[model samples]
Target: MADVFDQIEWNVQKIFDGEPVCVHVGNAMECELKRHPSYPKFHTEAVRAGVQPASSSRLWESLIAMGRLSDLDGDCTWRLVILDCIIPSLRSVSARVSRDFRVDCEEIRSDMVATALEAWKDTATGVAPRNVRDRMVKAAFDAAFRQGKATSSERPMDDIEALSWQEPTAQDCKPRASSIIDVDDIRDADVAEQIRGERAGAMLQRWGCFDAVHSFHDEIRSGHRSGSAGQAVKTSRSRSLISNPNLYYYSSDLYPRHIGLSEAAGVMGIAESAAHRLIRTGQFPLPVARVGRSYKVSVRALMHFKDIPDAIIHVDDVENGALHARDAVP
Candidate 1:
């Protein structure tokens, strides 16, 4: 009864609109727009099928296509596709990755391309394409893992044993000084804290904080005055922190101890005027409590410590840290 294009459009729309005839991030019933960018027409016809917006039929096909779902041939029904081949592939596609992909992060962009290829392979025509994508994804992951691995020093085997022992046995250690400088223990804090004692001592010794501050200051002045910053509000100590071998102890973990320090330290290196400009534009990674021009905009010659939580974070870490396990909720 319907025209062929209309039929094709309707079928496609049904695929997009009906409860995803596949599984995606979760048991969500939303349309699989990311799986098929041209799914709007298909969604329109799904409404005609008496399928509610919450139905999985609308999302399933795209989910399966994206390799986010597995067809349940045994049950003769659709369910979330568990990544059975998890050890070889880290089941890396997740809600966080999906959301980030929607927002256009580089890693997420790479992941979606990987997913699209996997989805294509489900059908006979896409076999070669899927193989190509599989190889690419493996290469990308291998490269990333190696890069992450390379940023560390060769730790003495005994030091690793000590740290590993601390993980299960250490009831959160209270630093000797009971000062509020230890932001890691604070509850409900949103920012990170200062690196005190040995950590700060080492950084100050190796990098010379004042010189680092001046270098970052010059970068900020040059970038802002010359209009060449291009989103990189460069930092000397921050760069040092990233590159330092001493700090590598925390680098391998999800919530690196140093990040808490970096978040709390604020931009001590920049001028108050430059800091104010950077904060207004949200270019600075540090948080600002107020947004008015009258604020002096704290800039210290030494790193000023602010109290923040140990676990407080943005969505970006979800991919960097929590890509394992089944807890990702999109």
Candidate 2:
């Protein structure tokens, strides 16, 4: 865990050092930090404040505000700085959630990081920007709780509000039904995308590629993604982008266009059998096709239906994006 934290820190610093623009921007930010009255007696002190910023700590808010602005403007150094602060808190979250959910702590950690970034973006858009430390942690922790076991029975959507964060107080370690995904009842693409968001966010967190994903999205929007989909999208320009849009097109750059039913099931956080049932009963919302042994689900259509990233991505992506129907995992 410590190594993971250190590696992320090292990577962010390396990126800062490696890029001339980042170097120039970082040097400027460094001077600003030094000039602040909250200028830490020790530099890591600012970060410590971020771990748990006091209500009165204008310094923490200033740092986070700056960091966020820089990140949104395309400089990732500050956001990484913000992420560094949450590592300790996320570790604790990972520990508790992992124990409660009876899953691997590392997976929980990845989810926490992914959730934090999702929270980060959410905060940037609609959430209030103040109260830098506590809110971020709470949001991430709350999201992780819901993002628990993918296959865990999800609570009714109407009950989502009742799934408030609670301190562990009993022997039961099971994740709250609210925290798990249940796309089965999803009636719209937005609902599906929200469920799908967790998986896509997790994938980026695993790849340590938030920066790359942002760049990839930017390239797509800017008409420079460099594939046939890029050209197609550039021409028609109708993709409701992951985490950022309400309209999208089926682009091969996002996927090879579609994926197997089982793989789609994994990404959808539902049982493979349930997905098959959806197809059999004609309830599978996304357009489906029989491509040989398996039913091929349209990744972008699912994305349009659900609102996720990586397809924002499917995990099969890491290993050649192949998932044939009944392809036995050896």
Tell me the TM-score of each prediction against the true structure.
0.19, 0.37
Number of the top-ranking candidate, with TM-score as the measure: 2
lDDT at 85, model 1 = 17
True-structure lDDT of candidate 2: 0.50
Stretches of candidate 1 above 4 Å error? 1-124, 127-185, 188-191, 195-212, 218-330
- Tell me the tens digit of each residue's lDDT in model 1 across 178-238: 2233334445232232222223222222322434433433544344422211333222233
For all candidates, the clash counts are 23, 12
